[model samples]
Target chain A: MSKIKVVHYINQFFAGIGGEEKADTPAELHKGEVIGPGMAFQKGFGEEAEIIATIVCGDSYFNENIDKAKAEILEWVKDLAPDLFVAGPAFNAGRYGVACGTIATAVQEELGIKSMTGMYVENPGADMYKNKVYILETRDSAAGMRQAVKSMTAFALKYGKGEKIGASVEDGYMNQGIRVNFFEKERGSARAVKMLIAKLNDKPFTTEYPMPVFDKVDPMPAVKDMAHAKIAIVTSGGIVAKGNPDHIESSSASKFGEYDIEGLCDLDESTHETAHGGFDPVYANYDSDRVIPVDVLCDLEKEGVIGKLHTKFYSTVGNGTAVASSKKYGAEIAKLLKADGVDAVILTST
Target chain B: MVKEIERAGFPVAHICTVTPISMTVGANRIIPAIAIPHPLGNPALDKDEEKALRRKIVMNALNALQTDIDGQKVFEG
Candidate 1:
């Protein structure tokens, strides 16, 4: 098989440019070059594919001047006409992820070339474009670069070679919610009966749809008066007393901590610390109130902006914690705050 | 989780560094966090300055709860 030509897309940071400072760099194209993650992708392609060119753009630039950036990118991509357009494994950088997703989807939609991008499942870009093009599931941060590249490389090879693409579950991509027809040995009635029997016998049966329909909540009225409000504190930033006396696990905490700030006006390193293991904990360890703002609440109370601060605050680690666990914690915390006559809460998260 | 708290009927202002993520998840009342690890305050500044910054952020959160909203709203500090 001949080597399949490929074009790569990345942001300025991945192009070895400055971080946020260079986020406004304009779009540029480099021929016959492999940049940052493209090196890994090139290696993964391993004789099956060749990265003919690299497309680099600043995240802020692309997002800020979307129409211009996209038009320029589309023109360059059309000129190259590569077999595949492989965009970023964007991790959690919002603007970069959106740019990658946008360019990939547009390349495929307008130019009729196969395109793909990679990002964390929850990235807003993934939501906006997963249905428009193939988006490989990736970790929330750059720490997961290797795994993301490996999965994306495999998918690119298969798709570029005109091989049949499998279901998103089997292909390491986000489910686009597209209905697909597949051959089934049994009739619909027979399959339904089998499913019913499985349910009756307490056996596991996979449902056709895996995602739950989103539950929409009507926005409640805002607080009427700040001066009379009794405010409470809650966090998924994992701000807890030193040593984590509640023994809450760093991530996926099954329980939450309820610490008293009865008369204390400030939280210092000696008295409180973070149990969160997600990000750099240096700052949070130096000052727990940085995460929970106990000191600020006290100042607000003294200033009469708030009637009072709740004596107790609720906290839990949000790092990798399941939605169900968080929801449960919130319900319990709300109950307690309501019982204490608290009028509002300031919930912080990492 | 912030959504659940609101569902329980008490007003809640979610302070998070990534306001986009909060908006994507449908957190109704939102306040921008200063940083991810230290959402309420930044530790890089002088002690007194950090305290004031924290105070400003918390005040914004408090103000957010009082302001009525029809949908996702991000309160400024």
Candidate 2:
């Protein structure tokens, strides 16, 4: 059989293009050759699979204009005649991983092609798209480059040969944490019996597979009277003073600031600016009212729909903040709101 | 975000464009919004339509606050 053709997708950096400045560069298809990391994969897979084309675009370009990027990239790959597609070994770069995962999953879904990418476990992109494609668990840095490439190539070769691929771990990919029915070496009854026997014998027994534990939260005491409840408006949109006096970091914010707007009816660009770096800053800057909508909430409060508006609005940047940090911030904000006798909160996110 | 807020001891409701994700993530109550960026109002539309959509969703959210449910409840009218 002839060598299976493959196409590789990579961000601008990996394609020898510059950083954010080149982020808007449109998708380009290079035929008959492998780019940087593709060469490594090609070497590993040998002639069993050949990278016939390389599609490169900037991370910001794809993120900002996802539909256009997807259209252009898919159109480019349509003519490449690739049997398999591969995206980045995106290390711990969140944007790169997201770009890779998005494109890989899209190609797999839309074009019916086998697609694979690699990302670290902590990369949010993995959690978002892992269920849709083969995502190899990779090191935080490129230290695992050789091994990652080799493993990805092995899976690609198997896909090209139409062989039965095993579980994610067995196939050298991260588990998406979804389960499917598959024939097992041991029966369910036998496994259960063994576990029971071990437990009765007072021996340590591990579950065959442990389910993820979702922290159960005790429900809050309901407000006695909705009409008498003091409602507060809190936002993770990072609406801070123009200079960001509290110095909240854009993405991974460690601190939250409460701004007093006691006499103010509305927040304007001169008074507030977005510390959120995730979305376009233009809209939030020109119209701080859009992100927070405190004016609307205040109007409702004046209508006696709520008892009182909190004197201070809590603000923080939500983008790329870990769940743990977010939880901590939530608890802190809750404590403050509770102390002030605020019965309810209307929190918004951009 | 709504889950974290509710978990912190407040009856919380989420006004989100993606109801499926919020519902799956165990949001106590959900009110569907227009889109991700402009959840309440759509600048592209005329002021009347924008107000109507916002009013409808906001009302639904307020209604969600008053009602009790056994599990994650999505407001649909």
TM-score of chain B of each: 0.92, 0.86
User: Evaluated with DockQ, which candidate comes out highest?
Assistant: 1
Best by lDDT: 1
Per-residue CA lDDT of model 2 for A135-159, tens digit only, reads 9888766777887787788888898
Model 2 residue A180 CA deviation in Å: 10
DockQ, 0 to 1 scale, candidate 2: 0.27
Task: Put down candidate 1 lDDT per residue, A24-46, tens digits, no spaces.
Answer: 68999999999999999999999
Count of backbone clashes, every candidate in sequence:
2, 0
Q: Give all candidates' CA lDDT scores.
A: 0.85, 0.75
User: Alpha-carbon error at A185 in model 1, in Å?
Assistant: 8.1
**i-RMSD of all predictions:** 3.1, 3.6
Q: Interface Cα RMSD for candidate 2?
A: 3.6
* Alpha-carbon TM-score of each model against the true structure: 0.73, 0.71
- Candidate 2: TM-score? 0.71
Name model 2 segments beyond 4 Å from true. Answer: A8-48, A51-81, A87-112, A122-125, A128-132, A139-167, A176-208, A216-226, B16-25, B31-57, B73-77
